[model samples]
Target: MFKRLAKCIAFANIKGGTGKTTTCINIAGYLAKSGNKVLVVDFDPQANATSGLGIDGTTIEYSMYDAFLNQCQGYDGIPITKIVLETSVENIHLVPSSLNLGVASMLLQGTRDKTGILKRIIEPVKSFYDYILIDVPSDTGLFMLNSLRAAEQIVIPLDPSIFSLEALEYLKTYCRDIEEMSDHVINQITVVLNRAIISNSTQNSSGKPSPSEEIESRLKELPDPVFVVPQSLLIYRSQQEGLPISHYATNTGKIGKAYEAIATHLSGNSNVVTIPEREAEYAS
Candidate 1:
């Protein structure tokens, strides 16, 4: 049995460009800024989450790929603690990914317990952090399967498009299948609407509901509340500069607040409290 002390949450979507990595990093930044220890496991071979937090994957000697392969070969995997690197954000660390991780699926193909590899790799270090956020690749393969099996909760980022909505439905089915196969039951699944355009005039111009409105309408039939992260130049700038929105702008900034609200909600805090000391801790 896996003993998990940290809240393992995965930001996963089958479709790309849904801001999965963006949401994972910013929320983790806010959580870490709040003084909670957080670890981000960059499960995607692209390593966007690794670079977005200002770490270069190429420079890392060992990565998630090594850990997964070592575990599969019945060797004590590279201890997750040894692979963890501190990010620019205080209290946040990362287990970066490399292009070699792209072949991880193939490596695990003939393994006896392929789906449970990640859970075993993370089990030893799970007690060391408050939250462990896994950034999964945009696919329904073994890599994504391991992420889903390892997480206690799943956060799906939707881009407010028909394709994204369809992908959500597919993910829901996949989750059900996973539940049937594993002992771990994913108790909570949150849907976050990213890059939402909230303009009534824009909706009227298109003779249809705006992206936000359309997503809201679709969400009413779902079990989770849709948190909105508005489209903003500041958010784009932050990403371009390889910083979390909270690090790029003050917590009071519109984009920053959106992430904070989601972070606070996920943390189950009824009141949002600002830790003044942490504000300057990671300030650029």
Candidate 2:
């Protein structure tokens, strides 16, 4: 039997447009490119990660929602192996999410182990991957809790916004509370600063640090390693093509380099790039 050694990590943030799905997809792409097998679990109800990997939503016969719905309804849940699907990227697989995912949460309303349901479903597939990245939603509900309980590592992706800062503080306290409630320690935490406006020529009319700069400064105060992903048009273009920045961004650029560093660091390779204490801009 293969050993269950995959590092289950969650790319999470409590606000939309914070690059939660983007960070997760790029990280998964980079990891798979490095010969590390990866499994991306689209735990979010929106299922952006599923389609972002080029998996057609209409073709999915089984998904993470089915697994939870079956288990909650006392039916024989489908094995994760059966639900796992090949993605556009080699060495990477995905447990796609569907519209019914929100319905599955309703079924867990009164379950004995509501939050542990996802953990149970993922346990069986842990041996097949080196990294299992869960793309969770922006909330403190069952979905977020389930992923948090199941993950050994957490990556908080944030953009330049006041709401993002609030989310970060909230998550810090929320993770602590969960740790106290359950014995599961969040052994590792990484903060990824996304959508940073890194422009040297552009001048802020307000004469104050931009939101991205302010958030960067605040994150520096934390002990966790922080990575910066600059705002680029290529990110949106790549998403439109349902491909990761690493895969679509074949050119040498700031965005790709930053993500590569993150994948390397997460793989325990090196203390590579971090949020440097300097003003840099990603040319659009």
Among the numbered candidates, top TM-score falls to: 2
Report, for every candidate in turn, its global Cα lDDT versus the true structure. 0.81, 0.84
For the record, the alpha-carbon RMSD of candidate 1 to the native fold, in angstroms, is 6.2
Tens-digit per-residue lDDT, 35-119, candidate 2:
8899999998799999999899999999987778756855556778789999888888999999878877666544677777788
Which residue pairs in candidate 1 have backbone atoms (N, alpha carbon, C) closer than 3 angstroms, thus clashing? none
lDDT (tens digit, per residue) of candidate 1 on 166-263:
99999988888889998879977888878877655545776686766677677767766557676778766777777777777764455687688778
Q: Clash pairs of candidate 2?
A: 198-280, 198-281, 199-281
Q: Which residue runs does candidate 2 get wrong by more than 4 Å?
A: 1-4, 205-208, 277-284
- Scored against the true structure, residue 174 in model 2 reaches a CA lDDT of 75
Instruction: For candidate 1, give the lDDT of residue 105.
Output: 70
